[model samples]
Target chain A: MTLEILAFALAALLMLGGAAVVALTKDLMRLVVGLGAFLLGVAGMFLYYGHAFLATAQVFVYVGGVLVLVVFAVMVVHRANGGRPLVTSQHDIGAAAVAFGVSGMLVMSLRESVGGWLPESGTSGSSIAQELLGGHLVAFELLGVLLLVALVAVLLIVGPGERR
Target chain B: MTLLWGFLWGVAAVATIAGGAILGVWWERKVSARIQMRYGPQQIGPFGSLQMIADVPKLLFKEDIVPALADKAIFKYAPLFVFGPVAVSMVVIPFTAGWAPLNTSVGVLFFLAVPSIEVIAILLSAWASHNTLSTLGGLRATAQMISYEVPRSLAVLAIVLLAGSLRPLDVVAAWRWWWMPLTFVAFVIYFVASIAEMNRGPFDIPEAESELVAGYFADYSGMRWASFMMAEYGAMIAASLFGAALFFGGGWPFGGALGVITLIVKAILIMTAIMWVKWTFPRLRQDQLMSFCWKALTPLALVQLVVVGVVLVWL
Candidate 1:
């Protein structure tokens, strides 16, 4: 129990630290890093609460997918900027006040539904498999079909490539 | 106590990876040499088994070079990031009868999901190099891995489907001899995609040394550079062992003490096949690589998945 609490504290620290980096730093790359840390913290919380599937999905999608693309965008911009990425520190009181206000409002809004979002216990790997492969079987498997359709759609729309 | 145990197992897992990489490197040299009509490394410890002893010291003593323009922190730390995920994944391999080193409930899923994080580390290593070619290599690697991941996961999902559980122990426990033929196509797809995931040829466009000057780790030297190679060999080992356990039914036929030997032998056989395929195939063109993945492999993997699902339902 104490270990769990300590872990929870660590997750909280990561979330707070990440938010600070995102809010205070204007460097696009650092922002991406900060966002990654924040998303990881969120995933950690989900794992702590036994939302294993959600946590993994969060890491897979947000950290793996969204953040990577954002980093690429930033890198491309860096090349455009003649090497150095545009970065600054947002130390002004007005910006801080606005950021804090918006954050607090968001937290207040989420307070009621947070309990509903948190699962009673952490999900074990087996139960997630059963849930995904059983209850949501058709929907889940059809995702492959969805990907295949898109692949075919692109080929058809593009038509056979021009003879080399 | 639980944390202590986890730490100890983690150490054992890392040790297994290092040991496997050592053996794998020697085996790969010998096999590739035979394929080419060469003796390979004949000196030092009977057919070059101890070649790594010499290589390791040389690599370690070499001056570590960090590019002046490199992101020092990311550059220094990223190899661990690259190597660590594969090492952790090793912990979940269902070695022997109904046991894994870590034996987590979600072992199989954890094994598959965790390694995807390596892409981020690859990107960081490339970016930290501050070299255009390295960056380009990183991009190619990122795209290849992300693309191939689709079919790979679908292929492994077939095993989860068969076992009706995510636990590696359960997967092996539920395995049957007939599964070898039944999921054969899935096994092949899994094997091929695993090679791509490891960035071996014909999918090695990321580090196509002829073009990228060794790609993302180009700027790294000495021990840091060695880790990347170790990670690749380690990944090959882990994938082979996992695949052997899932599709080959691990060691059930041999049973008892020999079960462990059987599983290791199966994995080594798979690893040899991987090396054979690597040596034989020419690297694919970038466009060809992407096309082959999307048009050919992905569809075939899906068909395999459907076939497995149907047969499973019938049974």
Candidate 2:
């Protein structure tokens, strides 16, 4: 029990530290890498909670899918030297204010939720699948439609080119 | 006690990764050399078997170079991100029945999920190096991985649907001899998607030498660079092991030590096939690579998944 707590605390520290770096860094590369670290740290926390499937999915979807998309977008718009920071000091105060407000609300909500937390762990992927297919089928179909719409929109925006 | 055992298993995993990487590298050189009609590493050891092993010391002893304008910390840790997940993925891979280090029920999903993390490492190293070519390479890699990952997962979805379980052993168990003919398409799609995902030959446009000039790792040197190479071979081994276990009947008709050997032999056979494809296929143009993945493989995998799901449900 003590060990799990220690592990969780360490993961939380890593997550927060990485998030701080992502928020504060001047370099665009560091900002993205910090975000990757932040995502991995979150994944670690999921693992600590015995959600191996979720942890792996977190790494797969965010670190692999979302972060790569973020980097690719940066590559297209950013300079060759990568010299500029994506976020500048002019935005810092406004960003900090928003961050604080969000954090305060989140903390309060978290406190409210903590009292009802379950002690046991481990949710198999099959159970999640069953819930998604059986109970949340409508939501699942909606998500699929949403993703399909997004794909079509992107295709319409980019348009097709000459095929080989 | 669990913590101590986990630590020990982690150490063992790392050692296996390092050793397996060396062996894979050597095997690649030999196979490619044979295909190209030349002797590879003949002087280093018997049949040049120790060449990659010898290169380890050389890579370690070489001076590590960081680009002058590079983000030093990001550059340093980038390779770790590339290799670490590949190493950690060893835990969920089943050698035989009840033999995996961590026998989580989500083993199939976990296997598919882990190696995709390498793109982050590539993107980081490329961006942090402050080189235009490196950045381009990184962008190419990111695009390639993102495009192929969808189909890769979709292809695996067929297997998961057929097996009705996410565990590696269960997926293997669902396969009978007759089922092989039907599932072969998914296997091929998975194999090709994996090749693209691993950024190997034909899809090796990310680091096309004539174009990008070593691509993302152009500025990386010494042990830092070695880490990236190790990561690539590690991914190869993992992918091959996965293909073997999932598609090639896994370690069956045996148990215990013999089962482990059978599993490895199956994996190596798949590795040989990968090597053959690597040596034979010419590199695809960047645009062609993207189109082939998005326009061809993705739709095929989606169709395969649907067919499998339908068949599983109805017949």
Candidate 3:
């Protein structure tokens, strides 16, 4: 029991520390590294919550996909040295304020709404696959279609002049 | 008790990686020498077997220099990022019955996913060095890994379809004679993708020495550089072991201690094959590598997956 508590506390600390690093870092690449660390820490917490599938999914999606995408985007516009500051500028202060305000509101609202609610035990991979293919097939197909449309839209917007 | 189990397995995995990397270095030199019709490592232990033993101290004692304009924090720590995930992935590789260090439910997925984390480390080293050549190498690596990962996962997905489980042990145990014809295609794809993923042989654009001047870790020195080599060899060994586990009947041919020995021998054979290819083939052009992944491998893997899925459903 004590071991479990210590593990949880350490995971929480890692997540918070990574978050702090991401928020405070001044280099673009360093910010991406912090984001990767933050994602990994969150994935560890998901494992602690007894959702090994969710934890692995979190790693696959965030660490593998989104992190790579974010890094590629940064690399595209990345300056060689310390030319670009990663910190929020004065002009972006309003955006930052709004972000914090919205997140705080979300936390408060969720706390009030689900005060006594407990999450169900994690679902098995097979069950989730069945749910996606059988019970929620329509929604799954819709999501795929939406992604396809988004891909086409991006290509149309960013493709060579001939297609446009 | 579980703690002891985990610790013991961890120690064993570390020792395997350390010993494997040292031996792999010497073996690769010998293989390359034999290909070139020259004696290699003849002066070291016996047939230059102790060359790696000599090289380790040389690298360890050399000056660890940091670039004047480098990002000190990332430069100092990036090698850990490269080596750590590879080491962690070793835990999921089931060498024998009931012997995998950490056998999670999603074993194969978790095993494959863990090693992708090394991409960020390579990127950090390239960017932190503030060298254009290293940056180019890093970008090439990131591109190659991302491109090849799709077909790689799809090939494994095909195997998972036939096996109907993500557990490494299950995958190996599910192998049957009839499943061979289809999985043969997948096995080839997996082997090729694993080679590319480890950044070796024909796919080794990131570290193409003549062009990129040692690629992403060009600026690294001493033990730091050695760490990168260790990580590379470690990943290679892990991938070979995984390929053995997934498709080659794993440790089932012989039971007990012999089973373990069989699995290790299979992995070593695969590693030797990789080394053979590495020395024999010229590196692909960057554009050619990308096209091969996207145009050739991805489509073929997807088609193979569809066939496996269809067969599994109807037959």
lDDT per residue for candidate 1 within B115-232, as digits (tens), equals 8778888887888788988888888898888888888888988888898887788898899888888888889989999999999977899999999998888899998998999899
TM-score of each predicted structure versus truth: 0.88, 0.91, 0.94
Off by over 4 Å in 2: A105-122, A143-164
* Model 3 agreement with the true structure over B87-188: per-residue lDDT tens digits: 889988877765666777899889878888888888888888887788888889999987888888988898888888888777766777577687778878
Q: Which sections of candidate 1 miss by over 4 Å?
A: A88-98, A114-164
Clashing pairs in 1: A50-A122, A50-A123
- Arranged by TM-score with the best first, the candidates are 3, 2, 1
Candidate 2: residue B211 lDDT (0-100): 89
What's the residue-level lDDT of B165 in candidate 1?
81
Computed on C-alphas against the true complex, the DockQ of each candidate is 0.33, 0.67, 0.55
Could you give the CAPRI-style class of model 2? Answer: medium
Give per-residue CA lDDT, model 3, range A1-164, as digits (tens).
77678768877887888888887767777788878878988988988878788788888878877898787777666765544436555656776789799999999999998756433353567866776787779989999999999999988887886563
In the range A44-135, model 1's lDDT, one tens digit per residue, is 89878777766777777777777777766666556622554656655588877887899899999899788875334537655665666877
Chain A alone, TM-score per model: 0.63, 0.79, 0.80
TM-score of chain A of 1: 0.63
lDDT of 2 by residue, A77-158 (tens): 8887648556668877888999999999999999998775532343677666677787779999999999999999988777
lDDT of 3 at A79: 62
